[model samples]
Target: MRTTRSSTSRSACLPSLLLRGGLTAVGAAAVVGMAAAPALAAGSTTVGPAGDYFSASLSNSATLTVGSVTVTCSVSQSAPSQPLGTNSANQVPTANSNPAGPVTSTINAPTFTNCRTNMPLVNAQVTTSGTWGISAQHGSPSTVSFQIPQGGLEVQTSGLASCHAVTAPDGPASVAGDWTNGNPASTLVFAGDTVPVEVTGGFGCPTAATQGSFSATYQVRNVSTPSSPINITA
Candidate 1:
């Protein structure tokens, strides 16, 4: 009778142990699945290869305007020395979504040449203050929206004695445009986008205007691989 009772107890506990073991195995599998989930969702938006330098040249004459005063620049360019950075697609987002940014680099101040204003400042020179921010906010596989953050673009004018002006508080200005990846070179197009600025100057300045507009097109080329164009991909 003792042997039989021991055997019966062993049989009953065996099923319980197996049931608990099955539940533990299922839990472990769930954890493993969770761990592998992120690997499947790793799409991204990237700008060229990492650490690449690039230069942008104006494809068309650029313009800077405040109210009735318009400054047309025959040449404009940005040279980026900082290494390029990468970003995830979710971070940059699409044009339809609210996008953050993948600020690639702080570029050198853009140079504007042959700048002549609608006002009498024929010899006007456009000089920028502070480092400019290069960022990608939204896009598709071939195109992305670009930004130069506020304070990234501050233009101080110097030429004639009566033609000294500056964008107040460091321009409190920004640049917004679209980038389209292409062969030979990528293109950035700024179609007369306007931002707020307080223009202060001695005389013959557009102080009455509260906003400024920039319009230009640029072609971006990779410095390292001159044959390859810089690409912004999502």
Candidate 2:
């Protein structure tokens, strides 16, 4: 059985994988182990700089099948309340703030089917963590992009024998959108391809095989004022 893995690129914002504090980048390397704790529940607000601080969640979901078993996967991320730093040129503070907190991704409700009697698939959950930032970009609407640098975050999963879930770990993963007046419910769609999960422990499939890939869309909203849109200032 032959499987392919996704490729990633370096991030300009975060050149170094490790930041000042202990927060790790997202697209680094996969650490085979049990899944980490579930990300903080959605709706939790993180107060930051003054421009546009909001909570964002990935809307698109993907399906990964192993042999006869299939599972639906989705991810969500929460920004931190503290400020990281300000861009000297633009004079605007970065999103989620300096010494940024860990932005976490949680897989919503995963289940499995079609497993052997003895090696039945147990609980399944995948979590990704990384620092986040907003960068200035040149375009029609004058937009800013959100980036989770390579090696800035870590991916892990729990439940399937030696199988562990891994997201984009080699390059930076980001999404951008045009400046919005103030629509908090606006959705920013992007692509997060190839979540290669390793299946070991003689669980019927070959060891270290690609479980499948996932594509996601994120919805950005202001938690403070649910009805109001988040204001983005470049």
Candidate 3:
């Protein structure tokens, strides 16, 4: 009981650029900076068929403040668009689409149920089903978040990615193994501020396949001013 992909739909590709921010304490000054690598574009500017490209798509970036330092940055990411859902397998003469494959859920148990089987006392065996559906569409980067340790946090995304070639998560499927978009998450730590805890997650599908919709969200939290925030960038 899985879904299929459509021909009119776009084939998908996933690429991700993950960043982490950490804070350290100085006397009384606040410092902020992008984690590890300096702020730079990391994903596909334009996705093409294996060896092709279309246009330049850039991610959105923002800044926040704790005491004095201001970190400035920009993100550029993109994922391919997906197509209409697929037809049931073996139902030939339908149409043509990429074999939607091994898209997995973040959780091993990702379904809702309503029956404890055999015990039919006050209720019947059923599930008040609500699927945590996923799709980091084409030219979409599943989940992309940006943060300046001492500064603030912002997000720019199209979607998360799945292992397209695996072909399991979505049935009648092929596997699109390990594309990098559908699963979305990001964080920032100032100078060493460890109090104002901040975190986010893509609780549902960490990896996504083709045929679904852009149905993912991003989150941000600022525990306390990033401790000893230092200015890594402007």
Number of the predicted model whose lDDT against the real structure is largest: 1
- Angstrom error of the Cα, residue 52, model 2: value is 3.2
lDDT of 3 by residue, 1-234 (tens): 011222211111111001111111100001111111222223322111111111112223312111221122232222111221231110111121123211111100011111111111211111111111111112222221111222121111123211111111122111110123211212211222211212222321113322211111111111122122111110
Candidate 2 similarity to native, TM-score: 0.44
Global lDDT for candidate 3?
A: 0.17
Ranking by TM-score: 1, 2, 3
- Candidate 1 per-residue lDDT, tens place, 4-106, comes to 1112212211111111111111100000001111112233445555555666777767765443345566676665444434422112112322223343344
How far off is residue 144 in model 1, in Å? 6.1
Q: What C-alpha lDDT values do all the predictions have?
A: 0.41, 0.31, 0.17
Best candidate, TM-score-wise? 1
lDDT score of residue 227 within candidate 2: 72
Model 1: C-alpha RMSD to truth?
A: 28.1
Using lDDT as the yardstick, the better of models 1 and 2 is 1
